[model samples]
Target: MRRLFPVTDQTSADRAATAPPSPGPDGDREWTFDELAEAYAYPPLAAGAVWLRGNMVATLDGAAQHGGRSQAISSAADMRIFGVLRALADVVVVGAETVRREGYRPARARAAFAQRRAAAGQAPAPAIAVLTASLDLDFSAPLFTSPLVPTLVLTGAAAPSERVRAASKAGAEVVIAGEGPGADPARAVSALAERGHRRLLTEGGPRLLGQFVAGGVLDELCLTVAPLLTAGHAQRIADGPELPVPARFEPVSLLTEGGFLFCRYARADAPWISRDQG
Candidate 1:
């Protein structure tokens, strides 16, 4: 923690003591920094099993990215929200493709959250997860070398055991997300829930997010609508295949910051189509 940036409000012991358990919202929730944490443990106000919430910056025209990355849409306040969101996560799950494209590293600077976790008797680090259909990952990256917390690789049974072992050797936790040949998003959440991770924050690159919503596993959907407009080739988040699940879930809260629109949603019920679109 010596090389880390200190919290700005650390002078008062009382304030530091009550620094708030913030649930990751990327700064969209109406709750204060501390109120976000309350959202985490808050019992399901509805029917979704897991929160499949997403955080992203979209242009005014609804483009999720401008130049393959959504960086251009983020503002200073949104960045602060991003930090709080990361701190709220127990594990930050991402795809291998995203892991490589994002210059990814798992741990973030949230000394307050780390201290709170210590008080709760849990490790200060959130388990970084990489989801791969075939386990094609770069084992040489520092994301795998960080010993403070090991990355978890969630894969299917068909995922080669040899590759899983290699990932473990690279200092990652290779956990089979499901027992079958394919990855089941539902089973993956169940696996995490079994491990006591009742709250899951899933950051997306579009396809994965669509799958979560398509599979009926998303409990909450959090989106931070960026004010900028980048009418570019970058993927639009909701442009993927339509989800028959949860036809409609009402918004619990809405926030605006740095010209971005933050909307919170709760899943209503299972609304998957009666017939699979096979």
Candidate 2:
């Protein structure tokens, strides 16, 4: 189907010079999963007008890579939390590159994600979102082939004519959202927000994650730190002149499993920021 609001200059970064506020516990109350669940009662972070949640796995030594792939560092428990986080999200956003490497699906648990939404008077399934500078996508994959719900493909203005045609032919709903010299996550997230999707869960490939941070879109980060360290150098997360930003995260909570550490970070009330100042 044709996009209602076709974006012409999709690559232009929607960088609002001001940074989004960080989140944390209110008063003495700790921001627990249960509290967030209650607050985002509508399946994900809906109560908030705009909220961004990022999911990534890092190593104990603070390396995002271990072996060539993050799979080497992940354990069964880590995978489960990934699913749980997905289940709670209204829309799952990922980079096309991540889909090429890690592979992605709709991540809809009609029963689980549905149950939560149903209880909160929400829809049964959340849409799967893919960001790409090009409209290039394998429509044959389950992500696009599903006849019921159309996959939302976000692209930039510089997308080729043939690639756009191919995406439309493959039964995908393509929206030219952001453009950049590379990729503009700020525009992409704002485009989604305009579409009525408020609380978005971004499962990044690092480049997009960095773009969001630079663009000031991300509000919360759910990072799973595995106990094991991957010494391999085949990992890539962000691309920029100034890479590896020193971000201060206020730990909402921590969980340890199979020697892995699962930590949640909110931009609000991050004690680490103050510590870093010292």
Candidate 3:
């Protein structure tokens, strides 16, 4: 793995304790799981709001997926970081479409993170929160029925009663955020915060990400740029209609391994303006 930049001299113990040695010039700068977890740790929290963060991966040409799923473009290192991020979050928010497409299962407790989670006062595993408007999800699926923490379905009051009933019966904790059929993303965040889930993480499927952006609730984005290019109709990272104005983000950090670039961008101080209000 090749890092874009050089690392400063560090203690022999700290350097050696990190992941395996890299074969490249940055041999002394190899990253271990412990080091990566520390680097990507969630920031200090605000008093009463959820710190929303999005994690995504894309190809060199900016294709978010190949053959209709993101797994084709993901690397082992990316997945390692993915697991660390999940272990750190209180809840993993996802869209219903992504859950279906990726065949997502309930997040289980990782032995590696078991101590850290317990020390942090977190549950054995992060709860999986599925965002849906119609509540058209499979209640029998492992995501709903077999999670360490009861799964949450963020929907609207206007969602189909039968579907809501089925989800509840299957051990899901359904949350109604808005009056309309579709949930208001801002309200969804608030609802999660009310339940004491302040460390929020969203693994999106584009459209749901767009809603977060539209709601001006997105605080940070962790994007992995894969070295390969898929020159097809593959979607971009965040897909939504044209915004009234552009949102700006500033780079926080850039790490690279095996030609893959891990980028973190934090939203600028620009005020968030929800589309519904605009």
Candidate 4:
């Protein structure tokens, strides 16, 4: 609801020094959804280029989920931002496990984004791209049969023939993204890009995000830090094989509302050193 970083003249040091602490940077007035959309707009890219962003929420204690669901740790403001991200993206990528756990459904076209999407030449609703090696999914579900756009299944070349056939039979397009029995994060991005989906957003369930991180293909991260602290054995926002070196990211923007901190981080320009180099 309030812009906390990249302070503008309205929230400059001089103004803050002379004025009392206000609810938002612009006094009692909160930011509108249009303002938030502008603030979070994707950077311009050359034709055929792709930018992948990961949006996630975690507790103060670093729990990505509570009781196997992220909604438990999410707030209304977070959900609003989630909708905005989905509206802006060309495709929504997710791991199959997340689809099953979250009871995935087709993305409905939002009236608010219809005009913008039309102007940008995007689909009325972003397509859902599921990454699964086994192709173990409910192909008969609405996510595959009723999507405004056809759902995409990203798998490996070595995936089971029967499952891939089933997915194709149910109206879902199967894309081979790896040589092994799993989807390679970088290849998946390229596959989508080839299909004209340059603005990609991934709503991860940890492992999928980890693959993106490990592949060094994630361009930006929009993370919401919940105010509450849940002390339990829970996965972090990313989980996978340890990296040779921790990849650095620079904070691009920060916002807050009702004790929740929304942080945006972009991949740092510096090159990362691998284990052999180190």
* lDDT against the true structure, each candidate: 0.62, 0.62, 0.81, 0.86
- Candidate with top TM-score is 4
Q: Which stretches of candidate 4 lie over 4 Å from their true place?
A: 10-30, 270-278
- 1-278: candidate 4 lDDT, tens digit per residue: 77776566554454333321223334224566566677677766665778899999999999999999999999988999899889989999999999999999988899988998898899999999999999999998999988999999999999999999999999999999999988899999999999999989999979999999999999899999999899999999999878999999877677888899989887786221211110
Residue 236 displacement in candidate 4 (angstroms)? 0.3
- How do these models rank on lDDT, best leading? 4, 3, 1, 2
TM-scores, all models, native as reference: 0.76, 0.74, 0.87, 0.90
Clashing pairs in 2: 10-178, 10-179, 11-178, 11-179, 11-180, 22-267, 22-268, 23-267, 23-268, 66-230
- Tens-digit per-residue lDDT, 48-160, candidate 3: 65678899999999899999999999998899879888988999999999998999999999888888788877899999999999887878899987888999999998989
lDDT value, residue 94 of candidate 4? 97
Give lDDT: candidate 4, residue 253: 72
lDDT of 1 at 271: 27
Which of 1 and 3 is ahead in TM-score?
Answer: 3
TM-score-wise, the better of 2 and 3 is 3
Supply candidate 4's per-residue lDDT for 106. Answer: 86
lDDT of 3 at 270: 23
Candidate 1 has what TM-score?
0.76
Best by lDDT: 4
